[model samples]
Target: MSYRAVLRTPHALRTFLAALVGRLSYGVVFVSLTVAITVATGSYAVAGGAIALFGLGGVLVAPLRAGLVDRYGPRRVLPPLAVTYAGLLAGLAATTWRPGTPGWVLIVLAAVAGAAAPPLGPVMRAMWSQLLPDEAGRQRAFALDTVVEELLFVTGPLVAGLCIAAGAPAAGVALAAALVLTGTLAMVSSPVARAWPRVEAGAVVAVRVNRARLEPVLVASGLGLGLGALGLLIVAFATERDQTAAVAWIEAALAAGSAVGGIAYGARTWAASQRTQLALLVVALAGVLAVAGLAPGVAALAAAAALAGLFVAPTLTIAYLLADRSVPAAARTRAGTWVNTAFNAGSSGGSAAVGLLISRAPLPVCFAAAAIPLLLSAVLPALHERVDQQVEADPGAEHDDDRLEHLAGEAAG
Candidate 1:
């Protein structure tokens, strides 16, 4: 769990870097494609529709794709999809560049592009279980995963800005596709990936391990409410201020705060169960997000945003950790996908809901809307207590009740 261990372990380092590069590319691709399409058509609505289809493709099939990885291993599943996705992306860029290519045609290409893209998060997360058996080690790794994702979003937009400024926004998409392909190939080629265990029925799939892991997945979905709301608020607040450009940096500051928080959280150990920490962090998030709505101006919102983001990474890390431990190895990838699916669905739905509300109410209403999930998150103390009961029973779990108590009375009793 130490920094040196994560940094020094060859397999850990390799998995971490591969996931990082692939995610960075994914972060850049969507925005860059939107920019290219918007510039070409002079219609943000058209671009939005296309991007929505792209995201929908992934959301719809993520579990199925992840299941394939679980059943067949990453080596069998990732390479061909990566190659096909790369080709599709390149084709989409080229098609968009053609003079007067039909919008419908571009939309179809986008769907294919999304469908072909590798399920990077699920695969990498599944690998962590095989590579790191220590609970503390996995916790640190998941925290690092959150940090990498935050940094990727922060950097992705910057890269898109550069590509757009260069008068070839498609370059950003192509660049991202290239990075993902290269990184995925490298990851699969690694020794750990090649040796990844395939699930054989009745081998190690325990009944307890197969129990539903839906709680953390649901909380993760709830956690995305703020992020989705923030997406709309970016446009709403920026337009209201007549400095629409400032939204990017404001959001970047928030992501930066998240990344820093994740690093800090991982560097130290806490004497609390994952479930307890998640509940506390989520309640804290609710408070921070609500306070953000009352900020006097954009500058104030920036500070509030950063403060609000402080709990995000740690909360998400705990959710992933819970998912990893809750499922058998054969089902880990699929379980991880449930978390991803819920998170994306929440972000999209939350943004749309808040966007509609903004039209009928004050801007603060939008900010308040984002905090709704946090309220739901705050209600998870019961679930925390239940999960703690399970953990305390697990022989491998760190059961130091003297230092870390579940929120309720003895869960077993």
Candidate 2:
């Protein structure tokens, strides 16, 4: 095999390790911060409001920030961001005992912290494409990346719960922040991260509102909302059965299933077309809906939930890969921001919807409700592919479908 081939072969392992380090530290800190803020405020609503502020900052700035990554490269931007984030987290820790610290101050700190949120996930995805430099290698790299993200969250909350129980939530957050800074800095300095392509001057950049890049992003965002809803359902389902403590197990099973699916999909030599991936997504959605009908016990529900989650990481990884191939390098970060923003937005909506649904309807219905968007997402791939073909075949056919075609092409290169 050529040098590039060998390099790509090892990339999956390297990316997973690096991402694992980043995820463990950051995820733990995030959970700890949430717990700390909630305890200090003595109000779940206030805590949630604080979190909402952070999400808002992330959503508002993600596109602009992503553009910076595209301009400066991940290596250059990530280190400073990580360091600053750690410093801010430490500052929050220092002020944990100050009586009557205004809520708005906390909100501002949270927003700033969130705005500077680590670029590991997006930057790493971009690096995978660059490091692997082939369609197949890139695909596998994304698959593992998705799995790590899902898995890390499973550990993050458990660790945070322990720290909170021990009356040291701030310590946990500080530790998480320090580890994140250390891990990101270490990874960026490593040969793997440094091997990524440098940003060239005068690359064909496109940041203005382009319909071609917006539609699929919206769809991906919708998918995020659906996943968020699924999470809420899991929590509610467990709560309904008075197995609230088992929430961790539910999340773990879901993450495990997702990791397994991603590994299996990535290792396979026989690649599916984008269309096939979409079809499988539909199957996965069907499975999710089927979970609602499963027997109601922690074990059975967990098993069904895991099977349902098996499709999630792979599905998301494919979407990221498609967006990478479809968007221009100049617009890649913005495109990524669109997806991330969609996820955050969807998460907020899904959580709310699921909470309301659980109160008003059956638990199974909650699961089935989330499936609707998956079915829509499934249709998007074929429809997008057809639109892409049309745009390629006749570039000048000025039709709305042509606009949709342009968007599809932008999303699925």
Candidate 3:
């Protein structure tokens, strides 16, 4: 089915647009907060600390927040979180309006703001799962979602830059607050969000971590690790050649390639299972990334980056699809959140790990090292399938599995 068909699915356009508006705030808040904190405290160190805390708060609390959405439903849960988050952001902006705000205060506020940040992306994906039950339609929806999110991230910084150029960094924060609150309220007002049934608090069972469930999270982390390392690697590559300005063009090429790849991937229905597709895509991505280090010049490196980028969105979209299909409806949001958290955590770890190696190793070696995670993770899908086959081979295994799931659910309740 075409993307147009995906949009034509009842309530799809309304729900997706509302979610996008809220998600755009996520794109805007981090950079705005960093600049605002730095200007207020006059220390990049303080800014860095605040940003770290902000990320820590959001990442650490994400699964829990997603769980709440799963239990209580978005209609009941999202508004309060959005209100608290926006309020914190507004307060943070107010504090940064004047110089000499205590660094500790800024750090504390940012941490709380992040903790209160709504899980709009996961919630939206869950809604998509509900809205589009047909596999082909769902795939298109996810691809469109991923591509648009990529654009938002790219556009968000430019929006912040404009605010910064106007000498009102606080405006960006306030604007982010407005965007999130408005978008969330609008989203919840939609039939899709409102129609989502709240699982009784006692109805939820713990999510089972079978091979099928775990594979997507691992693959997502690997993808994030490679992409994260590539960012710094690109910068380092340009710096060594005394052509730092080329870094932006190279990154742009990567994003452009991803967007095109995502659209094309969604436009066609694949014959392979998501797991098989995921493995092949990761292998292709890893091979390209490894070859990227051998580029003869900036132009060649950009081309390699673009080639590697072709696999990114498709890989992630498949990972998310696998994640959604791995669990019961009540656990779907949490499952997707785990994938998101893994990717973010992997990105942070990749950047840190590569930072230690970049100065000590050749650029080619660093690139190869970065590709290692993707290469290793590419095997997980096959392993997952093997486990599935094993389970299916035992006739009594299905009953036992159901019992275990019931017991786990009771314990969770």
Candidate 4:
């Protein structure tokens, strides 16, 4: 299916556009908050702490927020979360309006705002599963979504930069508040979102963490870890050569590669199962990253980075698709959220891990180390496929495995 077909899916354009508007706030808020807090308190340390707390708040509660949506539907849950999140952003803007605002106040407001932030991305992915029931259409939609989200992150910082240049850092925060609030309200107003059925309060089913489900999270986490380390490693590489300006161009190349790769992956149908595809993609990404560390110059490194990035979006899109397929419709949102949460957590951990390694080890060794996670993670899906093949070869074994899974689910519940 073409991208146009995905857009033409009934109500897809309106709902997706609205979600994009709200998701854009995510790209804007972090930069705005960091700059605003720094300007208010005149301390990068405090600004950094506030951003950390904000991220922690969001990550910690993401599953719970998604679970709420699973039970109550978006129309009933999204508005309140959006309103509270926007209100906190506005409050944060007010506090950061003038110099000498207490650092503690800014930190507290940011954390609360993040905690209240709506899970528009996860919810929208769930909606896509509903709107595009066909696998081909769903693949195209997810690719389009991932690519646009990448663009939003790139654009968001520029918007914040503009606000900063205008000498109104807090205005960026206020703008983010308006965007999310308005966009979420408009999204939920759509017939698809409004008609989303709510699960009964006690109707939640236990989703077993089998190989099918766990493999996606593992791969996603590994991919995030490798990419996260690559970001800082590239900067370090450039700094060592006194070519720091090249860092932006290298990062831009990576983004460009991902966008191109996503469009290409979605535009065609593949014969490989999602599992095999994910495993191969991760292996390719790992190999490219390892080779990137061997590049002798900034230009060569940028080319390798672009090559490594070609698999990034497709890997993530497949991970989400795996997650969506692992659970029933009612639990898909939470499942996808878990994959996302794993990726973000892995990214943060990767950055910290690489920071320590980069200082103590050779640059090439550090790059190889960064690729370790991806290499190890690629084993999971391959192993899962082997086990599935074994089960297929033995009918009694398959039956027993199903029974075991059922019992596990029961125990989990």
Q: For residues 1-413, write the lDDT of model 1, one tens digit per residue.
A: 68678656668787778877877888899889998777767778778888998999988988778877887789999999899888888877776664466777778888888877798888888787777878877778778877888788777888988988888998887888798898889889888788777777545343342223766777888888778888788778878989788887788778878888898888888997777787888888888887677777788888888887788898888888888888877878888888888888998988888978988988877777788887785555445566557676875766534323443345435
Across residues 1-413, which tens digit of lDDT does each residue of candidate 2 receive?
A: 23235345655456546656776876786677777777676667766777787777777878777887777766887888888878877876655533355666767787898888776777777766666767777777777677768777777778888888888887887887877787787667656566655567776466555444554565676677677887788777778789999877877777788888887777665556755675577556556654654556878777876887777777777777767776765456556667767766877887887777777877777777777766666656666566666767987876756566566577678
Weakest 10 consecutive residues of candidate 4 by summed lDDT: 399-408
Better of 1 and 3 by lDDT: 3
Best by TM-score: 4
lDDT over C-alpha atoms for residue 217 of model 3: 95
**Backbone collision count in every prediction?**
0, 3, 1, 0
What shift in Å separates residue 165 of candidate 4 from its native position after superposition? 1.5
Better of 2 and 4 by TM-score: 4
Cα lDDT, all candidates: 0.79, 0.70, 0.89, 0.90
Model 2: runs farther than 4 Å from truth?
1-16, 97-100, 191-204, 207-216, 290-294, 386-413
Better of 3 and 4 by TM-score: 4
Which portions of model 1 miss their true places by more than 4 Å?
A: 201-212, 386-413
TM-score of each: 0.89, 0.85, 0.93, 0.95
Worst lDDT run of 10 residues, candidate 3, spans: 399-408
In candidate 3, the residue pairs with backbone N, CA or C atoms under 3 Å apart (3 or more residues apart, or in different chains) clash, namely 205-409
Error of 4 at 310 (Å): 0.7
